[model samples]
Target: MKQTDEVDDLLTRAGARWRADQEAPPEPDLEYMLSGGRKHRRWVPALAAASVAVIAAGVIAVLPDPKTPTAPTAQAPSTTAATPDARTPQTIAQGNDDFLVKPGDKVQVSGKIIAVPGKTPVFCPPLAVPDIGYPPGKEPAPSCPDNFAVKLNGLDLGQIPGLSTIKGVLSGEATVTGTWRGGAIDVDVQTALKPLDHPAQTELECPVPPGGWKSQPSNISSTAVTKFLAAHAYQATGPIFRYPNGTSRGAPVVILIGLAHGDADAFRQAFEKVYRGNYCVVPTLLSQSDEQRVTNAIGDVMSGNPKLGIYSASGPGLYGGRALAQVTAYTPEVKAALTPAGLDLIRVIPQVRPVR
Candidate 1:
């Protein structure tokens, strides 16, 4: 049989079964109709009973009164308004624009990772153009005024060789999540998309040196400088003689010591010891004016110019009767400048020296 015909046959059988299972309605009261009446009377009573039954049926059809109302079934939750499964990437450009990416912003930024000469292990590998200026008493301005820096914390750029020098500029695209921290935009590199191009060396304009050095002699005792240096892993084999006259140009001289690498505390301690020491051959011959000049020059080299390139400074110790300054050098510019100022410059060579 065809599908429709079979379905109809099955429905008909089911309906018949349903009807058979239901109880039959009571028979009509024919006895009441025949009793207490003549043949005409019986016919009238039957008609009246029929009319009453019709009225009752009509009333039931008009108004339905069920015993219990059914409750609405619980519906499954809709997934129509759920969060998106994918995020759209934001683009950031280089230069002096005020486009700041806040913490948790996923972005695609393209720029060159320019090498900062002296801000190593801290602000190294900053994402900027070369020759960024840092105004005195202010933060270093972004290389591209419109663009900001992305610090790749815990991410090794060294995996790509030659990335940390003036000879090379690492230009690439990175997918990152930005984090604003420590007054700068720090980024977590999700993916280094690609190396776009090699960076070319750009000329950096050095800031002009300040006029007239302000002298502030070290106040730290020689004992303190010696003790601090030894505690902080410095080879303190000095108090070495620089001036045979025990004075630098009629000024009492102290010992000069150079340090290749040390923090601010170490620098200050070394400066104080050398400045305060009375190691001059003729203590009376030592000139306070010469000592102040030497101290001022050291301060200028250490703090005045942002790019002075003297990692550490010490001394005004006696060297041939003239006050000399001992310093650790990472750049040639500092030596050139200090040498012209008449302060003897001793370059500290970096090496592991046995503790004395």
Candidate 2:
């Protein structure tokens, strides 16, 4: 996608759900790795079926608090409004589990601070872990139980405030401003990171018809529609937006299609003949098959590479053809791990980066 203000706002809002519920990320054991890594030809799990053009939420977790809540908390819909954080949008555009701060620089970043069982609570990157899960039906939204995941991301600190009293996981995102010293960041500012709701907006490159997307009368069965799309190189995309808000008919079905090889108008016309529902077709650079090919290659090659901390790997998205991988750090070893061809299609994201 073009990343327009609307898309940015939407993408940014989608991120706060990355904010664990109430703005906190979900639990640990968040294997960002495609579960079907062996099966390679799958769209990214990050893209939920709920909407098209929706990017996967950032992976993060929780820390211990004084009063430990034993039961796993479900990821909740966002309660707080998202505000622009005092971080670099350009850097965030780089995309590494939303760790906006670079090591060695005294800059502001957003993350989490959790308690260690017998140790003082230290501020750590809220990169999602392997324990907590997402709320039911909300695949991409991480669950925000008191027991969220918190990866140290190569830093173990004893610098957060009120550490002496913390007993269990600190259960929310925190705005952290600090500098990299030897190991941990030199703490400067620490505050709660407020959560934001998902922006329910989306757009298309093709102009709307004169009637403004009115339903057309036709008869197209689900099976025939599937066969037709597959015949014409249909690539499935994750759900991103709900159209025709407040329709009593039920949840609005808006189909957003991206074409890498065919003409957008022609594709839409062809699709109209196949199905009688709402849909928008736009031009794209890569096809789902192409993305699957590349991502499958990535899974094959990067599967067992040690110490690179491969958290998750996804196929191409609606925005671009490049696949995305969430890792612990973007290091030399990581850079050296990928085959040049794999590197061409994959974007490696780190939970935390060093002073570069």
lDDT of each: 0.28, 0.39
lDDT of 2 by residue, 1-356 (tens): 11112323343334322221221213222222212233212222221211222223111100101111111112221111122233332333234323334346554435556555554344443333334356764344222222122233333344433432323334345555567442345655566553222222223333465666643322233566757755654333322222343222232334455554434565567777766655666543334544445445445444555344444455434343345555544544555565433453455544444333
Candidate 2: Cα lDDT at 184: 47
Query: Per the 3 Å backbone cut-off, how many clashing residue pairs does candidate 1 have?
Result: 21
The residue-by-residue lDDT of candidate 1 on 1-356, one tens digit each, is: 21112223223333332322223322132223223342221111111322321221111010111111111112221111111122211111111012223334333333344334343212222211223356654544223212123344444455433343322333333433344432233545435444222223111111222442112223233456546634532212132222223221232222333221223344555555545532211111112222334335555654554343232232212121222222222223544565533422222211101111
Provide the TM-score for each candidate, comma-separated.
0.20, 0.49
Model 1 TM-score (2 dp): 0.20
The TM-score that candidate 2 achieves is 0.49
In candidate 2, where is summed lDDT lowest over 10 consecutive residues? Answer: 59-68
Instruction: Name the best candidate (by TM-score).
Output: 2
Candidate 1 regions with alpha-carbon error over 4 angstroms: 1-287, 316-330, 343-356
Give the Å error, residue 238, model 2: 7.4
